[model samples]
Target: MPGLAGTERKNIAPGLAVSIVLKQDQRTGKLTEGVVKDILTKSPHHPHGIKVRLETGEVGRVKEIHDEE
Candidate 1:
């Protein structure tokens, strides 16, 4: 997570429609959102970060993982 916090880019979430920032895993394309459901760093495609399903029930990868502001 070094050199990531100062990117000036906000994290993303499901249902918020985001552009692919960086695709760590083509199988699980990375996405950046302005809003999200549950944000957490888990063991998945992106060992860095991932966003959970919102009220809409959708899960996706977060190029940048940050709490809701």
Candidate 2:
């Protein structure tokens, strides 16, 4: 799913890798890849994307979830 509404918390664990769209890159629809450090979205679903903080300290909405291996 491109948006976070279809994603579940279990599917996006803290150590999982993911591609997200940062605030600065939202206009270009750029994707930043990083390991999830924290899940900021408390709601069950969001229309835009699930807000999360990466290990690198970058915060954005998850666009795609990637496997660790």
Minimal lDDT window, size 10, model 1: 2-11
Candidates in order, TM-scores: namely 0.31, 0.84
Backbone clashes (count) for model 1: 1
* Number of the top-ranking candidate, with TM-score as the measure: 2
Off by over 4 Å in 1: 1-34, 40-48, 65-69
> How far in Å is the alpha carbon of 30 misplaced in model 2?
0.5
lDDT of 1 at 37: 51
Candidate 1 has what TM-score?
Answer: 0.31
Please give, for residues 1-69, the per-residue lDDT of candidate 1 as tens digits.
Answer: 433431222333344433223344546654544444554444334543444444444444445444334
lDDT of each: 0.42, 0.82
- C-alpha lDDT of residue 65 in model 1: 44
Off by over 4 Å in 2: 1-6
Model 2 C-alpha lDDT per residue in residues 2-49, reported as the tens digit of each score: 433325655667887899999999999999999989999898777677
